[model samples]
Target: MRSNIPWLRTIEQFEDEAIASTAVRLAPMGRIDTDTLLSLHLGMTDQSVSTIASRADAIAELAALGSFDHAKLSKGAWRMFKDRIEFLGCVLPVGWLVPERRRLAPGQMASAGENARVKNTWLLSGLICDVETGETLLDRCPACLNLLAWRNLPNIWSCQVCKLDLRSVTPRQSPPEAVAAVRELARYLLKRDIRLPAPLGDLPSPDVLKFSAWLSYFRWLPEDLGLAISPKNVPAGFLLLKRWPTCFDEIVLKRMKASTAEDLAKGDVISRIKAAGTLSSSVARLPSAAAQAIVKSRLETLFGFLDGSSEGFQDVMVPISELVNSRF
Candidate 1:
């Protein structure tokens, strides 16, 4: 065991995996993935562990390996990584978007200051950008389109598969509004005192922001809406903006109504309710009665839009009504 171990202090904006991964590299552990390193050193079986206690234990164990048993880790090390949120595992070097005056040698990787540090919020929200520089974070290799998360490379600034220096690539221009949207989200994630803008602020809890991001980025909502600025064009985090709730609601309601109507038209009462049931399940975490009522009203109005028939409306609304009742 190396007594003079170069343990990198955790940057406040670095995600747990990023911190762990960089620590492994500085430990000269030779390219081991974060989970394997944790399992080998700490006997941790759960790769999804993100609790402060768990992270503190990991720091203590890692320090022990370096013969520093009494080393103290800061509480700030574990503050930003939330266990409830799933890992996006994406990273962007701090200066990736800014063009360098001098090009890198064929194999040289980019570094921000001394080392690359990814933003903590980007790991959660999958919004790739450093807001201050107005630069988008590159999560994919420009040469091969290989995802950054696909391989646990020793250097985060180089693509493992293609050996491409990410700093050498030209970046796409992110929209100003899109960057602003992501900036707001990152601010909210970092500081609890900072309230999210309107409509998003109307949400019951900040946890819902993750749900909304999922719906906007990964779910079928974008396709259904035929959004002018597709999720691909801008950061998916932009869809969580204060201006987007009405558009999101309209599309979701439209989708639910269309899906329900199609099933009802086939005279499948069970299928129609099943479709509505899925929607209800997705929004069950919404705690506001007013929000629930709005969803219910929109769902109920689906009947009015469908051939002006009231029959079977109650049947379709059963799941939604139950959701509302349960929440209230």
Candidate 2:
């Protein structure tokens, strides 16, 4: 990689020292959302649609059922590998590097210059079990990184691990009021543009508070996905995010819906979820519909501010462009 991009180089020094340290300490593990993991095995890792998008298509097409070492790379991708490395600041690693038990993001890896510290596919597989109703889907396990399965486990009742006795059970945990609150909060967050009025610490029941968190979770996806999964006024052709096969199980939903001792307000949901109160602790630990809400809120703010500033600058520049053109 070129070492002459002044802004890029300067920003590296400006990055938080602790963040870099934490990044280095965990870069080996790479970025795996632990909250999204369920069960896993060892094989050729990196199989998500996201990965496919990130990789050039020829590479993806040539990928056979068991081809690993010598990847079929088109000339374009090979050259891109060079250009990518220049931009990416690292070599394209050729083998399975055992993953260290650390969690770091791709951005962090770029900043820290630490490639796979170890080799472990943070993946899941098999029927995506509904966390609440035990409904199995042709989905992957949220805990482990693996491709989802549907046909093999038609009536499998027991968990692959810990023999937790996951099977057909009466699904009676959803509360009507709780669902309403969850749906409203989700809709609000899905389109949250301006700062929301501070939650007036006046919500009812702990269940209601959880519904708030679920709202936050639904907003984390891209806008289209957000619309599809939004609770209130979901678009005409969109399905609720709860039906999403990529990133949910009834278990997580149940936890989001489960009520606590007191119904906290909106702000409380953020503080409590971040602080992780007892009931909050269980549901807030990982990516829930709620945690996603928080992330969405933050990103929306960040992007909103950025987009606004960009628009304003462009508006200001319009007259200058016109004046310059007049001289010409």
Candidate 3:
């Protein structure tokens, strides 16, 4: 059935967030979480919604039912949204990346790079500034330092707790190169076929790029080489190496291997058992052994990139192989 709500139009780059925000406004209590929003939009019970596997399924159901008009989305934009949701997970966890607050008039739609805040996506969570506007995404209320929670507020641009107009706060400065790196990553994620710069474009597939990006977050990798331990600096560091492919050389590989070796050396039988439990808990989504093997192979390919060797090269694989075998 077509949606009876007239203001339920999708915002271009902000489609998911817009839908989420609409769900919150429609809630009788003025606040609703992800599951409740899914149930409400899909006309399902909370229990039934819980059974749904992924956000892509919910979105597809919405599209098929004409809850969201297909004509409103540019063909390319709709395809990218569907592909990203199907391939990656949902938009990265809510509130992980600070968001820019923008006012949306009823039935209004806005595109990316407008003088408004950009929403987070699974691939773009580490962004600090809007690539187009160069505006620093706000993490908290400047007036009260309260963490921003979009769903909890009535007006997205106003801090519900402090009543501060977030837009009035001055934008913080970020490095231009850092902003460019994020823009590149976002573009790559959205349009995998888009020609990219050097080493990123050389990669075989978008999945390989994602696998390498995921490896950058593995806890055992050295802080300097991978993402910073500091939460705030992570976005700046997320694809810093990708922007400079030469940085992934033998020396960097040696450093990561040393770090992995040190971690393995610290573990005991009890620690190994604990690691096994941790792996089991974390990889529940990848339940099959074949799925785990695919991850292993992808990770090996990433190591190969670092050491300038073909996939599954023995010397580089030793450290990661030992770690994975020990944990599993």
List, residue by residue over 203-316, the lDDT tens digit for candidate 1: 644334543443453245436555322223234533544444455555555665654433334545555545555565445433345545545555544433344443455444
lDDT of 2 at 136: 25
- Sort by lDDT, top down from the best: 1, 3, 2
Q: Write the per-residue lDDT of candidate 2 for residues 1-328, one digit (tens) a residue.
A: 1111111111111111211121222212323221111112112143321222134532333222113221322211212242122111112211111111111222222333422110111110110121222222221233454332211221122223333222222322324444443334323323333232323122221222233334444434323343322122222111223333212333333444523323222232234333222233223423234443443343323223233433332232123223454652
Per lDDT, the best of the predicted structures is 1
Off by over 4 Å in 3: 1-17, 22-123, 193-245, 250-328
Better of 1 and 3 by lDDT: 1
lDDT of 3 by residue, 173-274 (tens): 457866776676556545554563453444444333443344344333444444533323444434543444333333234543434423432434444333
Off by over 4 Å in 1: 1-17, 28-54, 63-83, 86-113, 150-152, 194-207, 214-294, 297-328
Per-candidate RMSD, Å: 10.9, 22.8, 10.9
lDDT of each: 0.45, 0.26, 0.40
Residue 160 displacement (Å), model 1 = 2.5
Candidate 2 overall lDDT versus native: 0.26
Clashes of each: 1, 35, 0
Tell me the RMSD of model 3 versus the true structure. Answer: 10.9
In candidate 2 the C-alpha lDDT for residue 215 amounts to 42
